[model samples]
Target: MAAELYPSSLTTSIPNDPAVTPSSKKSIIQEPDQETEPAPTSTQPNANSSTETGSRWQASHPTLRERNALMFNNEHMADVHFMVGSPGETQRVPAHKYVLAVGSSVFGAMFYGDLAEEQCEIQIPDVEPAAFLTLLKYLYSDQIELEADTVLATLYAAKKYLVLALAKACVAFLETGLEAQNACVLLSQSRLFQEPELSQRCWEVIDAQAELALRSEGFSQIDPPTLETILRRETLNAREAVVFRAVVRWAEAECRRRGLPVSTANRRAVLGKALYLVRIPTMTLQEFADGAAQSDVLTLEETHDVFLWFTAAVKPALEFPAVPRTGLTPLRCHRFQSSAYRSNQWRYRGRCDSIQFAVDRRIFIAGLGLYGSSGGKAEYSVKIELKSQGTTLAQNRTKFLSDGSSSTFSVWFEHPVQVEQDIFYTASAVLDGSELSYFGQEGMTEVQCGKVTFQFQCSSDSTNGTGVQGGQIPELVFYG
Candidate 1:
């Protein structure tokens, strides 16, 4: 069944349809209070502006009292009704046409245009009541209070109503909170809403923390097109095996969504063109033999071709890409401006040189950038440890040879250590060498590396001269 669905000669290229542009539709609007002042002729005020003059001017306006009365208070004043939400869980909200018309041109056209409908109630089955209420609050008071759970829905309502300010605010809020756990989901939403800036930011997080992003529950909820976009990302910092597992998880979720049995054929069917984007040929022979081959998601011929490609002198053309991804390039968060080797300074006698650091977002700490021997060619034994509070998270014992150069040598851990956000972690390194080496001077308290900011402070564990202001521990190498 799976082989009949997917042929071996299937091309990798999948045609992407253009983004759907949301069209403005006419909606029902209730009548306003008899005592309510006439609606303003001008467009909505800039809700994001914080200027004192604008605030004072709006405060002194006579329509403020009318707006307060009409806000969500649908007593005898409402003439239009909106039935929002899905069946069996619908909510009817009463709104004044004048207020909505003043806030949105879409509403104005809907209620007052030449071909406007005189319907008393409108069916809005796609939007949630909470999102609609949020939009109303912004129109009435020029203030927006957004929650994490409803922000995306609110963004949808704002876009539907052509509320540009609220949409921009929602995008900014999402960008501020973006992490590996939610990047995939946000990437899906950003693409859906045509938010290129937010999409780019989400991609940054996904690429840097691809392993964590792919393992998140949100990854399974992403649409097939977003899944294809992620699978085709050559810079994703994850192994091909991890990508395969994530794809399988997404396929399972898709199966459950479609009410189909979670069988191998169903998974393969749901995957379709996305399966070809997984780059199974890039996985090691051991990975293929142990995982993909056993999963039974691929046809027998496809599995055979993979095995032959691994062993044959002349490999056959496979559907999946054979080249490995470029993966993430590590960025160095430098803590100091210059390096100096004073006669009395930079001498290490097994004392730990530690600095406390924290990041605004989650990242993987690959290793540290440290100064080597200042004297002629020499070898030094080094021990590095990372700790949060009093508990140790990661530690490594390694050795490095240094020539009489000013370059800082990279000393890495066995594996990258995942660090949480805004929590202080201490990175300490103790070197066993008699020769005096270069120490970092004029240390910085804050260093901005790409989108992630590294905040440094003096750690109590710094028994050596290393501090945020001076001593050792020149740089932190990490992937965001």
Candidate 2:
């Protein structure tokens, strides 16, 4: 009883049922964990697995992580390499982050239109590989970024790659920045490229639009020499000389218009220089005529003499068929047609021979022929006649030389010799070289004896020799 009273403050604890075992209690306390980590399976690794294993950890659950894991771990994830620094360089960068350079911001903008619509976003991956790097560099630098030597290389590559927009943008940059000299250098270098259109556009922008090129001010201008080089490369066309000559004419005209006082001598020298430079047809007819006109400092008569010299230059060209005259015979001696009788034909019958030439609209006849066998040297004349209105073209004279005068004395005749009244015939003895022999054979009379050809004029006034007469109609006969 006393023990029970003393233990009241610390009463001994007792099992409710006294039947529960230690193992059973432990099992009850370790009830199934609500948030236990997943077990390591063949298909799933622990989140805190080894460094190699932990890399497999993904942000989402097992299904999503497993789906993307294979793709994310691909060995070829590295981006494509892109060239940098300059168009022709070996340095490269990742394709995704690159930019391009262009000359004019506007030029690049213009290229945007010609480029395929989808290409505008600058999706470098989708573009042709060749232009990608260069175009990217252009975007970044706003320039071609090619060395002077490598510009041609870049252009060729761009053209070959069908990156026309990039190629044209590069060309525009070069044309705007490079001087005429450098522009010419580029042209000479790219004369045989695949992009003729590009080259031509470059030239128009550089050379034709340049002020010095238009005015052709200096002796050392780049355009002239540049053109010379181009011509040497290709077969120069003849018609192109038209444009070349036009440039020359414009230069000369401008000089004059500006009161530059270009002397005839200086102008000629410049023209000759230009001709030589351009390889134009040497000594053209127009050039010769203009040069000759300017150079001849002489009086009207002296100028006429000079003109005769000029005419001689073109005689072969202007020569017509000896003023065609046919069926003209002295006294209608058809027998003279025989080769045997022709030798002395003039000795028996009369023949008329002379040339009617115009000197300042005045007609004169000078030639010789036998009047008859007995007349001998006494039958010849140096005659002058006035031309009538109806003569449009000159007629040829066909007559043999007289027996007395040497054959070298063959005459070039002109007008028809008719001894009729209203037509006052002027004749003189060939032997005397003197005395006016004026004979008047009139009244329905026809003097049809001629060993030579002659031209007849239809006149209106009878007494006016210098004036035309209007009385009769002359007969003309052509045998052959």
Candidate 3:
């Protein structure tokens, strides 16, 4: 990867998809009256903009898309010359210094800082031309396509150039794209560039799929700091012994790179810090005796301490054991939403999505979103309950904000509610007052064979009448 000085123009045709995209679908909450915007981090462009864009795209008149294309084609306004890529392989992108400076703090400092007076060519030898072109297009047009193939390079360029918006977009792109294969590679890249969101998503993937990550070819490329963070995280889905085994595996692979025998003292020295990060006292007594004592990495005192603790000869300090994070089940926690708004909705404001767990979990329910229309000057109160078979397991009550919008309603539980396995847990909400007309997904939910979820509707008979099917569930967010 290298480059030299030259002047040329390039096109942004590469892929780098964001988590959300523009859609022509109408907002659940009506347009003019609804002040609630979608989550800012939503990859999808605003529904309002998307609908207008779609209409313009279908019309016989000039559209924003055409205007954007025209700007890309019209290179007469270009000022700066960006020579991107390696020496003989470089592509020159014609850009304005103003665009560059405005898009990036690093470019701003270079072009208008103390060194501003000394004119210099913009040569980016390390950046891929495809990526730089995408950045240029975003700077010039305020839009760029984020896809799987180009996001990494685009992210790298975004971070290096200090393009915060593009950096955020890239993080959103990588969040949905993370998997067993690219988790380690992306984690390393995220760490290097200091993208906290991307780093968090990568770590979550690693945590959720620890065994797969440990087996990944790129696992050995994980940096020490990232590895330490992973080891320290309590939410690692795998058992303690499995983590210890993974640490040993990573250390041995690292030793091989240094051309030393895995059992050598030098190798153990390299693994000392990582080995200490593993909770020795948490391992099975057999695991400590067979695994820890056998690995020459542990010092005699450390090994003795673990042995003493396990044998009750010494009571180790009460350490907060890292509880397994069962919060990674997005499939179980998601609200069933379809773009097509139809009759499959609750006539009443109160509804619930009941889920029977296969295992016990510390359940935290995020407030539900209300569907349907809003009214003028109305008050509403929600009484939420965790019930099983006509018995009240747990309950909470709260008043809706003055705006009467239920879309942003949320209450973080002081303590996560303990839910039991093989038991029916219903998150029932009962609404009072003429606040808002809440909707639900009536018969759209397809409960799989031997599945756990059921729709529970508590109230709505007043307005919707006998038409209410008690089976339709409303939208609710869950984190456990």
Candidate 4:
């Protein structure tokens, strides 16, 4: 019989040799087939490997900022072009298709989904040309110096393009930079963009300056839902009577806008759900009688309830729940130690405070405080250890110099320890450097350490078995 032929796409089959075994022949074919597969096959498995070696390699891999910086700075021959701006006036920005696709899901879907974008050119008409350029810089460099004037617009553009990291950056900027002048406007913008954290921050700001916020024109424009949320808060620095009066002003403005009657019932109707949130019980009888009770905004039944509660005639119709634990104090996230501390020998620094990390992060020194002109400049040898149950789990050591010009300094670590979730650990430092220059009063900072405690102070005498000298604590910062 004649041998059968094979198609070009398929490999040619070899005839069984008279001297060869089937099993050995199978092994030879398998090895060649692996080599024939695409180059991506090897890398794909490595990307998802569970081994520690693989994890370390993945963690150390270059970030988007690093890759983008190298590509744009060195001009790696961009493959895509964006024709951005108004009609008849536009700018062409060069970018790599791979970078854009990786940075944004929107870009990824547009480039490679069911409707693939063509290779030639693309236009972004909605995003401001300048802002879009800035977004590209952030997308590539992993950093942008955001300013108040353009941050909101930049955020809008980022959200439009589905660049979550950039959007988050913009939100963070707005959060820290929010001021009385812009709080109301930011509140409105936050609602429009569905940024709950920013909105909550605005509310917290309002609580601090409720009277001032009430006087702002945007106060009247606050949507009814937000109004209720603010009114329901117990910690509104202003008295209940003050907020009740503001409620009346807001309601009156709302009524006049609709050309409705300015009567109390009509005002109450306009106030809607917000009226119930006011804690009428907290108001003094004199204030309620002269203010809230007389206002057209509070209903007769609600006013009666207020009057009865103040007189102890009856319990309030509804109890006021505590101001849903107002905004977190700034100190909640970080500890501040203004005093100076000195150390002559290596020992655990101070009391260990329990640290509960909401997210797994690697913590590093935020600043190394050094005293005199000569104090901060010297390179200090230091090592930090994280101990769990008296065993050292992780450690990082390096030579660091404090910024000579400034009291606060930052240093790069040679080996930053990886922290995991729900692990109880304490941090200790070992130092062998020049005697640190300190203030008149020695300050002892605390850390979250394991269950080991030692009675030691700032003494260099380690000649005895029990004596340990205290060490200076470098203010630590955490990163994920």
Candidate 5:
């Protein structure tokens, strides 16, 4: 019985017209033929039906109309869904006709610009409708999703479309990604694309990762054209130039360190080619030696030349400036005078000795005599002494009696001499204790001639006389 009822229910058919038989109308009401009729793609009528259960169904069986209405509503709903989630933009674009939203359509237009003329459809990835719409927003307003990873490629495509905003977004992404550790590929692409900002960012990253740059074999990996571009960049200073030179030099050093046959034909040729291409600073050993001898400081380029030259000529020369002189004489005072002191039974008054002394002063004293017997032969000896007060400081005695009895004596104080003030060469000597006297051709500093005991006769005979010619004792004179 169950199998028979299932067949009957499965074959149930709704009447096409309400004027049909009663059983046909009842079948349309209860056991409708869902299998025979085309199902509505919008919704199925069952437990969740809104178009079911009512006396309004008997008047007209509105299945086809209802289905058409549901389909139209669904299409409308689809339009609304896209408006909220995946909506795109279109315009009666200007003469340029470029003001279109980004997405598959824009990319398709771009891809079409350079594509072969005749094509049916383009095979592209199934981009999310939402993402495609987001891209369209970007094209229309230059707004982008910050967290969207595919935005970079989308920008690239947009850039191809000559969209200025999309190009800028691409540049920003490349530069930001270039800052990361494993962003060499991205940076390389940026450089290839001739993006100035991205290239600068990549160079900054290279400068920051010096060790990584050194280890990467990137020096050799970079072609001559690329290196030329980098080297020609005027932004590099002396320090950065040194780093650049080091990178190129490392390739040669690495070859040697690895025990590679650097002298081989191919290797030598390659090296020569590199030398020409690199335009690294070059100096002969002689030129380097001359530079070192002449200059204390050199720029990085000059230093590179010197290093290269030394590698060839193999000289061990140190580079530095010469040290300059550094030695110290004792001060000598030949003539010195202190404040005057008093001694002896008699008092002596004087001011400070106002004699200006010179290092080349000549002070000499002549012979000093005592009596007629000429005590200077014994006690009348011409004894000159330098004294501080009554204390004898230095004394020298020189006998001035000539063998021919022609007395002539003099003693010069060659260095310096001092004398007391107010009592200089006075008619009478000031005696602190004894007067200093000069004897003829002797060392006497002063003379006291009032003590003469021998009377001088005005006779030329050999007797004691005050005769300037024949009769002579010892005439004394002073020179100050």
Candidate 6:
């Protein structure tokens, strides 16, 4: 198979074997006069060979990798220069053609194939200097050190060179750090790179925590196609109003990038087809009246159509989809199997029923499932909080009127809290009620809900009858 070169302008065509076709643009750099060491040749010893001879051979000759490492950036035997980076930030990296050829088939075809061009320097304007150096290090020493800031750039360089191992490593690193904060940005890159698995993982986080992901600064930086993809997603868990606001923010950013004034017209122009995917008619009448109408992004006719569709018995034909999105249904992960209403037990006196929990992957904690009053219909004022290391991540004060049943009642937070992997968080709830309620028994230390596995531990703040063994907090409602 013929290996394709990145920056298609760099080469016309090169065979799979050792050869390269240089770019049309070329520059010559004077070669340094330094003593050069010949490339090392390795010979394997016989299986019956003595340990003494093997030790002597090892002492006299360093491994091939060690020699390659020594010649990595050394100009001693370098025959080519790579002019990497952009115009003002260019860097000339000296490298041995044979070593790079041995590591990457693309490099092999570029430097020593049948159609190889005899150029002293190759212009690499698309890749960063740091990322290029990292690639060279991996090729020379079979080792790579990746940092969060430059890993994406390094991945680009790896894919360009057809370095499959390094590219896989970069993808793994990115997947490990995937979260709601960076999922949008990663989703864009993953789609650009044709990495479907990474894109799907990113979509999972974005779908579960749509509001948070859309509100992220990275969402505004996504390309137009990626923005459209998000808008068209039917499983997004955010409300239509939130989606419209995020799209407006993205359009404003895009207008500024294009050096246009931030006007309603400019925003609509930048949004283009993406604006139609917001499902404005699906939004509540109050939401549409308060947000979309005041924004001025929608024209008078479009606004009128939406109002008629909402109130009029005969709905008008609208461009936007009127149906609400099929948002994610959070899974209720019960930590206990049985519940009991003991006499004088499960009484709430405002003491917090807290339990520490952690997950193996990023998930949105929508709410908590608690046992309601078993002594007839009762109303309780509840304060629910999620904390990490004493710092409150999310808190909500609400009221729930239990129907005096054995089923768990879900009390939701104002917004879902994004829980990161392996980070311990405390879910605490204080219920102010006069009735003795059903308490959980036969508590579990771990519960699997869909793809997320939550591990529970006893919290020091649990002063009431709520804990890993027995508690009022029976379940954690979450969307993975």
Q: How does each model score on TM-score?
A: 0.76, 0.22, 0.50, 0.42, 0.28, 0.85
**Model 3: per-residue Cα lDDT over 87-111, one tens digit each:** 7978766656766687678878878
Tens digits of per-residue lDDT, candidate 4, 166-212, equal: 77877876765554445665676677678998988776566555556
lDDT of 1 at 470: 88
Best-to-worst order by TM-score is 6, 1, 3, 4, 5, 2
Write candidate 5's Cα lDDT for 144-218 as tens digits: 443233443444444444556555664664443332232333344455455777766555444434334434443
Quote model 6's TM-score: 0.85
lDDT of 6 at 476: 91
For model 6, residues 132-193, the per-residue Cα lDDT tens digits are: 88788778766656666667677788888999877887787778777677788888777767
Q: Candidate 1 lDDT (Cα, whole model)? A: 0.77
Cα deviation in Å at residue 469, candidate 3?
9.6
- Name the runs in model 6 displaced over 4 angstroms: 1-61, 421-423
Best by lDDT: 6
Query: Can you write out model 2's per-residue Cα lDDT over 1-480, one digit (the tens) per residue?
Result: 111100111111111111111111110011142222332212221223344234544443255223223222122221234333333433433422111113333333434445423332222222223334444333322223443333444554455444555566545544433332343434533454435655664354332323322223221222343444533322221223232443455445434544565554444444443433332223344653454334422234533543454456543222111221221222221111111113322221122222121111111232233222222343343232323233322233343323432222323334322121133222221222312222111212222334333323322333222111111111222111
Off by over 4 Å in 4: 1-102, 117-150, 180-218, 252-266, 300-305, 308-480
Worst 10 residues of 2 by lDDT: 1-10
Expressed as tens digits, the lDDT of each residue in 1-480 for candidate 1 is 111111112121111111111112212222344334543222222223334224354555457645453344353456678887756868777778888888898899989988765998988876767777778766765556666666777778898889988888878777766767788888877887889999998887888778888998778877788899999998998889999999999999889877899999999999999999988988999999999998889999999999999999998889988989998889899988988886776788888899999999878898998898788677889999999998988889999888867788889876567787899999999999755898888899999999899999998889987898888779898977
Model 2 C-alpha RMSD vs. true structure (Å) is: 40.5
**What total of clashing residue pairs does each candidate reach?**
3, 32, 14, 2, 20, 8
- Between candidates 1 and 4, the one scoring higher on lDDT is 1
Instruction: Compare candidates 2 and 5 on lDDT and give the better one.
Output: 5
- Model 3 earns a TM-score of 0.50
